[model samples]
Target: MATAPPPKSQHVGAAVAEKATSHVAQYSPDEKWAERSRKAMQDAITNPPADAYAGRSVKNTGNLAIAFRSLNEILVRNKVRQTVRMTERHEKKGTKRRRLQSERWRKQFSNEVRKKVQLVIKIRNRGA
Candidate 1:
């Protein structure tokens, strides 16, 4: 007697379809929320605060440093050692002013402001 082929063994495609349908049941809203929260936290950590550049003088202090550097380059090109001494004197004056400011005063001044103040001193001295 020939046995009937085991009810044709449900199609392989049907087995895959059943698995896909059951997968929807396995989803947890809590897991999705946790994933989203983690992503948001990471994004926040990577981004700078909104006021990041508000106090930074991209023009003034930055330009002054560049000017000083270029001035040194010009002096080197001219083979003048005297301007280097002058640059050192200006830097020393700026450093002295910075050192003279009490810690309490420095705490009141932002870094950019402090840098601009020093830059001003360097400029006036350089001109003199």
Candidate 2:
């Protein structure tokens, strides 16, 4: 039986979203979604939509900073994906489940440590 793929949810991470909280996204997604995401992210960084800077002047330093900041976010997202893929290799079916569970634990623990130091405050209230 064929399985339908999960719906894609776009997440735009801020500077400290990684430290503040773990992203509740799927791991080892379908090949098509992964390929599409990689392409979209690259296109986003290189060919941002016109309205992204509608009223802002590129000549202004702050406006430029915003652009750079967004660029950094894309880089960070790619970095996280790379970090996962860096260690990834073929595993026996039994071990694959354990490996993913460990990844979840690591992500959970990371947030706990950051929370201890009160870095959770860095997360912005978006679209408010």
Q: What TM-score does each of the candidates earn? A: 0.24, 0.30
**Clash pairs detected, candidate 1:** none
- Ten contiguous residues minimizing lDDT sum, candidate 2: 52-61
Write one digit per residue (lDDT tens) for candidate 1, span 13-109: 7778877898575549998899899999999898756783333323445678886776666656665686456567555776767765865577677
Error of 2 at 78 (Å): 4.2
Q: Each prediction's Cα RMSD?
A: 21.1, 24.8
- List lDDT for all candidates, in order: 0.69, 0.67
Assess the local accuracy of residue 79 in candidate 2 as a C-alpha lDDT between 0 and 100: 77
* Per-residue lDDT of model 2, residues 1-128, tens digit only: 99776544434454357546666555565876888999999999997778733433334356877876766666576575566685687668778788789999999999999886564445443322
Reference-based TM-score, model 2: 0.30
